[model samples]
Each structure stands twice: as C-alpha cells, then as structure tokens.
Target: MRTHGWRGQPPSDADEARARILTATRTRLSEAGTTSTSEVAELIGVTRQTVYRYFPTTGDLLNAAAADAVIGLEAQLIKHVVEHLARTGGDAADAAVEIVAYVYEHLRDDPALNRLMAPGRISSTVAGLTTPSAIALGRDWLAHFPVDWEAVGLVGEAQAEFVEHLLRTLQSFVVDPGEPARSGAELRAYLQRWLAPALRR
Candidate 1:
C-alpha cells in the first residue's frame, strides 16, 4: 500500500504494470473474498481505467491473480502426490486421480482461489476458465504431471484434448461441486472410479 503509487515509481514497463496489478488483486483477494478494478487501482496508486486497460474485465483480473497463486501450488502438489502414492501405493490412474482431487481441494480450501468465484463473479469465473490463457495454463500444468499419460492413449493431440477435458472437469467441480461437496478421499475415489476407467485404453 504505497501512497505515492507503485512505491513512488511508475512501473518500468507494461509487463511490470500488469504484474503489479495482479499482485494487488491477489492481495485484495487474500484480505477480502472479492476485489474490484477500483480497489486494485487504489492499492497501486493508479486509475481504475489503467487497471481496466490491462484487465478489461473483472474476470480477467481475478483469473490472472488466481493463476499467479496457482504457480506456487505446483510444488505443493508435487509433494502431495509423492506422499499419497507412498501411502496408498497408487498407480498412474490413482496418481492422476489424486492430482485432480488435490486440485479440487486446493481450490476449495485456498482462500485466494475460492474467492475468485465470490458472489456475483460466478459467471465471470466460468468465463475466465474457458479463455485461451486459462486453457493454456491448465494444459501446461497437466503436461508437467508425473503420470504416464501415454498409457491412457493420451499422446499427441489426444493428450492436449485430455488436458482440456480434465480442465473442464475441474471447472465443473469448482462451479458446482455438488450439494454437500465430497471429501478429499471421496473425491479421489470418485475420480478413480469414473475417470480411471475412461483413461485406460
């Protein structure tokens, strides 16, 4: 919260400006379940119009911030996957199931992520996930998974399709997640039962 605006200095470039806005948006989400372009503008000592220039819509702002939060989550998932396999002696499908389950949990539990869909933003959140940037992010994340996607006949374009499929599934869970919402173990089992068999070619 610099009063002088961006620590009393303008962003070095457009990239820096966008980065600052995203950082501000994420901070606002951490502090409050929701944030607005004005709020981010105020935080960064910029105009809402400036923020809007970079993120034309609220969805764009929230999604960019959430994506930033997700970058650090990859390391957490890496560890969680290793431990889950060690404990459950799971296979590739199982690992994939755990990954999905873990992500659902992360989305459910992480304030920054969960809050992106705050109140009136549900439609925007859904819209955000479908954006090309969001799809690319999901695809890149899955591409780094340790699971043997080949065994599931998910090589080449099929792999890309599967990644999109997985992203959509996660999007469904995020949007609805059912009436009572399943537990992590229950989620894992659910994915294992349905998603696993589908993957086995």
Candidate 2:
C-alpha cells in the first residue's frame, strides 16, 4: 500500500529543478490548454534553455508528465486497494468493490483526475491511464493476489476474463458516475455469484 511520489532519496538540485519544470507544465496545462517550454520556464523563473535541458521538446514534456502521473495513479490505486482488501478479508469481489469506490472517490477529489475526466480536458496523461496499457497494468497489479486463485479453480482463462471484466466495469463506472448501474457492493455480490464458479474450475 506504499504510495510513491516525487519524494525519495533526498532529491538533488537537478531533480528538484526537473520536478519544478514538470509541476509548471502540469499547472500550465491545467490552467491553459496550450503550454510551451518558454511559458513554463517563465512561470518557474528559469531560462528556457534550462527547461529544454530537462525536456528537449513539448512532446518530451508531455510524455514525461504522462508517465509520472500514471505512475502516481497506479500507486494510489495500489494503496487504496490494499487497505480495502485488508479490511474485507482480501476477497476478490470485495477488492473489486473497494477499487471501484476508491476510483470514484479519487475522481471526485483529485483535481488532476477531475481535469482528466472532464469533458475536452483529455490529454496524454488521461489517455495513458485510461488506455488498454493502464488497464493491463491494473490487472497485473491484481494478479499478485494473496488469495489462491488456483486453489479456488479460477485459474487460466477464467481468471483472465474475470479480471478484464472487473477492470472494465470499474472504468465504465468512473466515466459515467451519474448513471452508475449498481453500487460497488452490489457489483461485488454479482461478481461473486458468477465468478466463484469459474474459480472453482
């Protein structure tokens, strides 16, 4: 449940500078749609050359921001899921509910995520987290389950399909909160009813 941030190993001056640059980029993007390295440099009171030194181009800046944001999002998901599972006996269905609830909460409270999910604010960071790549990463994170999937007979293709469906459902709920078809607990119960049989395979 460890949450990783830009904080670690006593960031060096260069690291601090890079973080400042990234932070500036995020701010500019959040505030204004188009952001240039010059604008970011001006905001941070640094030379454009310094900005370019850290990020050679706008694409590089965008890519780095996306990567960092996705990493942080993944960490947040891991921490929330771990804490929820601990309280719910680490059942997969319970974990699914916790994950959906956590995502909903974060989407509501996190300014960055709110922006990402907001209409027309979709950026590379948004795409990176919502893409198939991110979904796979989430499933891979769950694959490190403490529960014995094999013991429950839910191994192989059944487990894979269940994970895919679980992730998709959570994602769909995130995008359409207003029309949420079911509560997380209800969804969990439904999953257990169908998924337990597959696991017993």
Candidate 3:
C-alpha cells in the first residue's frame, strides 16, 4: 500500500486508513456529540491534510461516520424483519409494518443516530437518506429480508420501487414527524393499515 507521508507508521492500505478515520470520528462523536476532521486526524495520529484527502469536508466525514455507525443497526433491522416474517408466516404486509415500526423506534432511541438527526445536522442526514446511494442501500437492505418478492409478484423494478417508497416513508417520519407522533402499537397499526394494502396490491 502506498504510504501517505505520516508522522508515524501509516495504515497498511487506503481502506484501513479510511476505516481508522471513520472509527476515530465515531469515537469523538460519541464522546462529545460532534466531531471535526482535525479531531479525527489527531485521534488517528494523522494530519488534517491526510484526513481531508479522504473526506474533503467535515460534512463528508460526518456522513461517512454516520453511515459506518449504521452498519450494525442495518444488520439488526434485517434480522428483526426476518424474524417478524417468520413469526407472521411470511406475511409481507405485516412484516413491512413491523420493519417500519422497528426502524422508527430505533432511530428515535439510538443516541448516535439521534445526534446525526439533531437540529442543524439534518441537512447531511437528509442528503444521505435521499441520495441514490441511499436508494441502493435500501434495495440491498430489502433484498436481505427473506421476503417472498416473487410470490408477491414484486420483482425487478417493482421490488426496487417498493424499497424506495418504504425508504421515503421512513425518511418523512424521521425528518418531520407528524402531529401527535405515533409510537409502539399505534405506529405499527397505522403502518399496517396504510401500508399493507399497498403491499397486497
């Protein structure tokens, strides 16, 4: 791996260096509720210039770190959806409700995610959720849910469309929660009543 001139031994590869920076950023964010590129560089024992090469702006770095932090949450979400489907005997609509509710609650409760979604921090968060990458991530996430896409006659573009719709629903709820925010059973029931018919259709 090419060494970017370092004050000490550099990461073995570009991927490793990027990972280190993201990890440091997460650590700082967790401890201080925010992080800067310079802080991440210092934490990783690299210079700000090195960090900037990987993430041109602090927004870029925070977005990357937020994405990294969400990796585990995504796995947990997939697992929850799979288990919900199993329990529902492969009821796609019901599983969708459960999955949506889980995501809503998880985002509301997760400190790291909440921090990213806080007041002024929402622009980057919104960008991250609405971008093509977010759509691709949604596609990949839905594909892992063990749902019977073929049985539901939701294949190809239809499946992709469903994922995008679901992502948009979740994004809307997160960004501008409706009056009298729904929670627990109310949220699940609301989603089921509204979303189930769509899935069935």
Candidate 3 residue spans exceeding 4 A from truth: 1-10, 45-50, 70-73, 87-90, 105-137
Please report, in order, the local distance difference test score of every candidate based on alpha carbons.
0.76, 0.62, 0.78
> Once superposed on the true structure, which residue ranges of model 2 sit more than 4 Å away at CA?
1-17, 23-44, 52-63, 88-90, 118-132, 179-201
In candidate 1, how many Å is residue 149 off? 1.7
| TM-scores, one per candidate | 0.64, 0.59, 0.70
C-alpha root-mean-square deviation, candidate 1:
4.8
Worst 10 residues of 1 by lDDT: 1-10
Colliding residue pairs in candidate 1: none
Candidate 2 C-alpha RMSD relative to the actual structure: 7.3
Name the candidate that leads on lDDT: 3
What is the Å distance of residue 173 in model 1 from its true position?
1.5
- Candidate 1 residues lying further than 4 Å off, grouped into runs, are 1-67
Extract clashing residue pairs from model 3: none
Please give the range of 10 consecutive residues that has the lowest summed lDDT in model 2. 1-10
Clashes of 3: 0
Residue 10 of model 2 has an lDDT of: 28
Q: Which has the greatest TM-score?
A: 3
Give a tens-digit lDDT track for model 1, residues 150-180: 7768677776676666667788898889989
Better-scoring candidate (TM-score), 1 or 2: 1
